[model samples]
Target: YVAPNDSFSRGVKYRIDTDKMEIEQLWQYGKERGKEFYSPYICNVTYYNEGHYLTHSGGIAYDSEGNASTELGPFAKLEDPNTVLKSITVETVNDEVALELEVNSNFYRANKFTLYAKEEGMSDLELGQGQLLGTLGETNQMDTEIPAEETGEIVSDWHEAHLTEEVDMLTFQAKFEPGTLAMLVLEGEEETRQYFISTSKGLRGAMCTGTFLPEDDRDTRTVVTKDGLDGEYKVKLIVNDKKFETGLSIRA
Candidate 1:
């Protein structure tokens, strides 16, 4: 059966094969006023005998020609899960140095990892020699609330509202040391890409969001830092025990 609607230029096509006990459906949206538009679509398949169902939903941006131009799927597939290091930045928060790492991954579960720092030419795997900066995935969750004083004044006492917006962050604790090359190593799993920390200023105290994982439909930000180190340094991200390397530099 096919049902067409002109309200928003949308239509649905559905078919049923009773002999095979199978059902199929397709939903589509067409362009409006010779302009592009965004449409959300869903598809579902069910096997009545086996009582199994599979569903998929996403938003698509259609061009003027009624063709899908972009797919914004909200689901993650873990068959070959991987991580991408989006960016590394260093900033000072309240006189404390902070190193922020923006990462994207396809894994729902948090991976155990540790941060290490050593002299530029030193080996990152030398456990005894390399400084253990901090550890993550040891705790299930962490929460941090920014006090009202740090945020601003209360705007309404009766309504219990504040003038400045208070920020609450989910975070994990990590020690950051300045003046050394920083490296993050996953405990058991090999990384798909290597990340190197290079900056003009040294690192200080670091915090990360604990509950957020790569599969949470968003990017995860991890920050680390130490105090009192500044200057330019070339950092290399080595993957597979130096099999590949990417370089970047940070200025303060």
Candidate 2:
């Protein structure tokens, strides 16, 4: 057991030695010399089927009417992890920009990919076809070579029909700026799809895409670019569509 008020305490570890058991106190910084410590006090203890335990205290609350309540416990709930696009790099060469995306999910497979650019002031409901810069087929190679100025880690070992494959890379020529929104639509086998949009990276002329979404009732999501034109735009992954809708922004 660990004391809640003991800031120096790290945790507790138990060792079973035949018929004898030893309890060791773990500290963040080894052990203190001639220092006093508080005893472990029970607050709120929770147990899990996985043989794990969590203890928390002082999280309860009461209203004016004397009704007591407490926040959700640590093991109360769980959510599915979001699919991530990692190590995304955007580069500018000559007059064209290149995009490199690596899917971090081992279960989701992406085959077809498309990109669209929209103006800042456009209405959320009006997710026009924007500009269908281009699309990459089932292959992992791009038609045009990505110039050295815009090249990052290469995607290799892409096998057809394999769920866990290499990156999907594509390039296009377009002029975008701060407040401009860019959307990436990725299609996979059997209607498995994902969407992402550009967002501000809190830097001047240095934006990158992430998983940010706009608050609109429509199935479409949007994000505005931060201040940067370094070919990098922030984007947010919105939803995982299993129907593979044709429209740019529609209900999943």
Candidate 3:
């Protein structure tokens, strides 16, 4: 059996020969000097050439108490309002650091391509919008029926709410106190859709990507697609016991 030191994120470089089907290890950047290079989830080393490579040490995380944590940064952040997420992207040549950037969010991997490489797709992208392929995952819904307990008051200044509408979806943005129970209710003449908005931080069994992780853990953003619905709906939010209209309406 083989095991790492379990302290820092791990990085390794290998030499693979296609003709002979041979593989060789060039270096491993697990425990190096006084610095740390560890990314357990989605990161990679891009070989520019011999002795030059770009390493992405994404997924570095710490708990609310400022202790190093083994849990994935993005997932842990989702589960706890105070958990921190960070990514270290370094470009090293001959074991010498030419560039290093630290971001306050987790990433799948750093980009290996040069900026505007081949003017790739930029020309085409300007011409039209790309359509999302396949179906989106099911939107979480609250089945328990609760008629609007409309409170004439607006959500408190702390939430800092904003509702942005696109052609096919509405992105609801706000901040919530950790452990606070909340729900988003959309009432339209065609039909009504209700969703439970979770502000309570809790861990999940698995995580695919952390691209959508917000910089601030308290930031709550939910994308409610307008598909399969028609007409305009009054957007409202239920915090604790009372539901209040947002003074905004969106048409699907």
Candidate 4:
């Protein structure tokens, strides 16, 4: 979960200076203080008052011999028998530890919320309510030209593909072979778009959410946003050198 240039983990607090137009560091954790205060992934800090704060170090991982592991813990735990997961939460007041908690598990982040309003005791409406609308980004292009041999064949029956539309994206789910070159092509009236599908992932730095992770490693849940798309289009697929029609069409 760590980048090469930004190894290790830490929490920092900054104070903005309105007049000087500069920021000053109020306090920090997990710097030269060593590995005891470090977590490679899944940790956070919560601020309450001027001098009180809560911090969570939720991704401490260790190997069989109890040595710190460079590999991410969640996947390592599933693969290795001796992988250990640890989570720690601490509260500080006036830069001094006031409360501490430790757990034998992993969490992405620790959050503290108030349940009732100050006066009317109205419930917090936003609790347990959330939605995510992802933005569209650039798509990768195929290296070679589109194959000419269509075979007039539809997608293979074993592929088991299902397309679902959302607010601004369409998700295509299908099973594919690992390390295979697969592409999803959308042929529109005025334009055509080709997007690559990842058949396999080598290493995972983190698994913050499993919404799109398939139970089978070879299964892929590819999402294509409708940001730049319009009109109607026929859906097609390319597996290796074979091009196949999907008998699918969409209006964006």
Candidate 5:
């Protein structure tokens, strides 16, 4: 629909049923400089299943009421029509897991990142061993990666996830004892934690840390932790269930 600067133009709304797309055009009264006229243009375009799998366009602008689908900044200046995602890096330091993630959005949009983890012998992914430790905001060029472990008690800041997306960036420091052909389980009904395992001398055990998605099928696996010091080995996870087999040791 195109409205003339001097006259009114009747516009029509069209719906594409096969693609499940809807487009609307409406007429509005406005002044162009010193001239009075009616303007006809696409007022709104609503795509079906917008929240599920499809993406739509609305000129880049932030919504005051807070909506995720809305553009983060002035939509007209968006570099790409499709969404652009930032990059992330994960590493181990001082018996802790560190994460450096970047988000490239026009505006500060509420965001979440999820990392899944598993040990050598496990049947699923587990979040119990991976704790959320900290977060750093968006960065340019390179993101700042810091140690996930602290000298004090683990804080609650890094423990929440929206559905399958873990809300935090930092993962906790979880140490595992050494043993081969071991079946380690997390404290949840969802089978998590059956992933790759490695050891370092200073920590005196195996370490696994990263973000985890709570919903997924469990994959069985085996893990090896480091061996013997004279003390009882008790393992604790954020979720339910007791895991790990007895007698995990590394032979000299």
Candidate 6:
């Protein structure tokens, strides 16, 4: 019922509790003010004992036609602001190669993130020493639908509805390049045995899960793990396959 309105001759209604030292209000305008006026938006403020206050706020503003205009506050930041996958551990668990990782989106969108592995003793990473282990896909879009009547400017009826949507799992395959590491890298286009692992569910904030593999697996080289489908962000890569060989480590 309460709204922010600078159009009304009497000005918009506002509430301010003396003890609270803060005022919060919402305004609605009966008529749009020519493109000069900005659309409604949310704002925050912190009072400094003095009459003045330091305020920080942000939101999308629109013109008279309700078209998005300039954005306000910190929301204008350009960076996509990605999440961090922490506590990543890849080990042979039972018959399967288990990948356990933790990620914090910090309330941003993150798509399918994957893990990769490669043979050891390969000095050149670009020479193809890695393969996909698994994928963890995530989404933030809700499945809620908008009603026709409520969509129009004039309201008819109002009712709350639950969102019904599905999130897909991250997927990846395992294909160890078998040669002396040098041969596999030079060949480039060899059809290795690739294994497919299905993602079990969606992830938000963080995810911790493991996949199974055959016990006969012998991928012992300090394998290289990649993030996402493109295999970017090398997780772990060693210089040599044998313990006696010198160790060259690169982590992403």
Top lDDT hit? 4
What local lDDT score does residue 131 receive in model 3, on the 0 to 100 scale?
80
Instruction: Give the per-residue Cα lDDT of candidate 2 at 113.
Output: 23
Per-residue lDDT value at 53 in model 6: 30
The segments of candidate 6 whose C-alpha lies over 4 angstroms from its true place after superposition are 1-42, 61-66, 69-248
lDDT of 1 by residue, 60-162 (tens): 2333344433322222112112211111112223323233222332112122124655668654555355455543322121232111111122211221111
Error of 1 at 42 (Å): 6.5
TM-score of each: 0.18, 0.16, 0.55, 0.55, 0.14, 0.19
The deviation in Å at residue 116 for candidate 6 is 45
Candidate 1 segments exceeding 4 Å error = 1-57, 62-169, 172-220, 223-252
lDDT of 2 by residue, 211-247 (tens): 2222221223222221111232221122122111222
lDDT value, candidate 4, whole model: 0.75
lDDT score, candidate 1? 0.26
* lDDT (Cα, 0-100) at 137 in candidate 3: 48
| TM-score of candidate 2 on Cα atoms, chains taken together | 0.16
For model 2 the local lDDT of residue 57 reads 23
**Each candidate: RMSD:** 23.6, 24.2, 6.8, 8.4, 22.3, 25.6
Clashes of 4: 0
lDDT of 3 by residue, 164-231 (tens): 88776788988988877788888888777888777877554445365466766677888887666678
lDDT digits (tens) for residues 148-169 of candidate 5: 2222333232222111112322
Clashes of each: 6, 17, 4, 0, 32, 11
Better of 2 and 4 by lDDT: 4
- Which candidate, 1 or 2, has the higher TM-score? 1
Using lDDT as the measure, name the better of candidate 1 and candidate 3.
Answer: 3
- Deviating ranges (above 4 Å) for candidate 2: 1-14, 28-252
Compared with the true structure, all predictions reach lDDT values of: 0.26, 0.25, 0.73, 0.75, 0.25, 0.24
Off by over 4 Å in 4: 1-41, 46-51, 60-73, 76-144, 207-215
Where model 5 places Cα greater than 4 Å from the true spot, the runs are 1-81, 84-103, 107-170, 173-238, 244-252
